[model samples]
Target: MIPTLILLGLVFGRWWRSSLMAAAVGWPVVLVATDVMSIEVGLLGASALATMNAAVGVVVHQMILRMTRQLRPAGSSRSGA
Candidate 1:
């Protein structure tokens, strides 16, 4: 899920959009998995977990982007004129 979200975010060029998509994709799966396993997780608990997962995914994605940007030198494209 984290990888998918990050890839989609990169593809779409929008971090928040990817984050939202992660929540949309994750909610139903989590709910159904818990149901199938007969795990008693309430709505609030499931929602909280999903939210946290999305938040962490977004933060990690942003950190990677920041690090990549920092690695590039500022004058790389400029010719020695």
Candidate 2:
């Protein structure tokens, strides 16, 4: 649930790569907290969390790349020379 929400936030914010990097850090923190707090039955394990982040990150990153266009290196032509 937390990962999903984070991913959603990333998609909505159009900051997918950053979000996934955030998630890569975020998910493990979540799992560790769960264990420390004795919480159980979460939506996903660590691997799932990473995969989800990657999948959503790809979509989100592409959209971000499309939307912002500022991410491209300055003065680099898109067309192959």
Tens digit per residue, CA lDDT, model 2, 1-81 = 556744554564465555566666666676677774234445346535664656664676577777668777777887856
Clash list (residue pairs), candidate 1: none
lDDT tens digits, residue span 6-52, model 1: 45444444456656556655665666776743435465565555556
> Clashes in each model (backbone N, CA, C under 3 Å)?
0, 0
lDDT of 2 at 71: 72
Q: How many clashing pairs does model 1 include?
A: 0
Model 2 scores a TM of: 0.41
Steric clash pairs (candidate 2) = none
- lDDT of candidate 2 vs native? 0.60
Q: After superposition, how far is residue 70 of candidate 2 from its true place, in Å?
A: 18
In model 2, what is the error at residue 38, expressed in angstroms?
Answer: 11
**Per-residue lDDT for 51 in model 2?**
48
Top-scoring candidate (lDDT): 2
